[model samples]
Target: MKEILRSYKQTPASSIAARCIPITAKGVVRGRLRPITGDTLQNPAEIKLIAEWREASADWFTTRFPLSEAGTSRWLEQVWRADDRILFFVEDEECTPVGQVGILHYDPLKKQCEFDNLLRGRKGKFGNIMIYALITLGIWTIEELDVMEGFIRVVADNYRAIRMYESLGAEEIERTSLIRLEENGVTRWVPGQPGSSPPPERELATMRIKREVFLKLHQSNLPT
Candidate 1:
């Protein structure tokens, strides 16, 4: 029974160092974005929610790309171990884990960090709760950590995600081209060329949310 209970423990990502504190926007709203920590989540239901998130994530990514279950699990494990990556589980009014998000701080030379979300089983307006949490966290990180800029790379086909970033005042920086090749006898032609039957390059749209805009938004939402 002890071993089974240990297996059910909700382990926090190793990136965040401090204990998570419940934060509210003046009106004392429960289950907003909180600092990520080992003890942040105490409920077994939340752990189950996170497990569901992991399964859903594996399914989603595998359906989109050629990844094995082991590969996906390993990838998530590495992401959880990174020190510069801050991960948080977004909660609803009832404090239920609805989604997860994180900030990956890049090198100073890069002058940018990327924010992403794995929102699973979201309901109603709470669906966009991860976006709000991310934007708030970005502002806090910028002011407190003195980061220069923040950016996110979203797939061109993810229209909802693109729109959410845009709503947060993030602007498109560039569209990355991804080319995949098969080892078969035939050579694949480059994208944007006619009659070559080449594998089309995926457009990865990068958007930037500046520090000033982030601060302004956060301040506006704060209680006067």
Candidate 2:
């Protein structure tokens, strides 16, 4: 029972630090964007709501993450930290949570950041809430963080998402195989090795956008 329970339970990602940088920005679809992590999601009601979104979007997560719910939770906790990890939760004007996006492995010296999981639940229904989330985060990365460049590894099969990012001036640079592995109950992605075990692998194409180019396109009014 314990083992089974660990495999089926999922939790939301959160910041572990006492003082996290606050995020506030305007989202296209509805309201505005606010950063959320374990530290900010203390209210049980909101936490449960986030979990519900994850459950409702299980098919999405299962396909991309390919992990048990508990594994997903642990991975999320590992990703939510103070130094370089950034997780932003979107909320509407009515204060209803829409979705979340984040980045990891921010290299200040190199002035680059890798895109983390960018997911927003439309309550299991179909909507463009994700586009709004991406726009909000993309703007933040270029404008606020002052990063020179950013890259995202998206599944090659996710054409809709790829097209959306491309419309925002992201260019597909390269394609490679990425494997999802769980280490010590935490799930993470790594490049596949030769003669190693075949893991949950995907053909991921790396898309990149420069700060100047993306901001320039946005200034000219990115595809609405």
The candidate that achieves the highest TM-score relative to the unseen native structure: 2
Q: Encode model 1's per-residue lDDT on 1-224: one tens digit a residue.
A: 22211221234545332333233443444455534444433344555555566656542221233434454444555554555565666666776566776677544455566775545456624544665566556655564456678888776667887887788778998875544454443232223433334535555687988887876766655434
* Candidate 1 vs. true structure, TM-score: 0.66
Cα lDDT tens digits for candidate 2, 73-139: 5555665444676666665545456777777767777878877666666542225556655766776
Instruction: Tell me the number of clashing residue pairs for each predicted model.
Output: 0, 4
Give candidate 2 misplaced runs (Cα > 4 Å).
Answer: 1-29, 55-76, 123-127, 178-201, 220-224
Assess candidate 2 and give its TM-score to the true structure. Answer: 0.67
lDDT of each: 0.56, 0.60
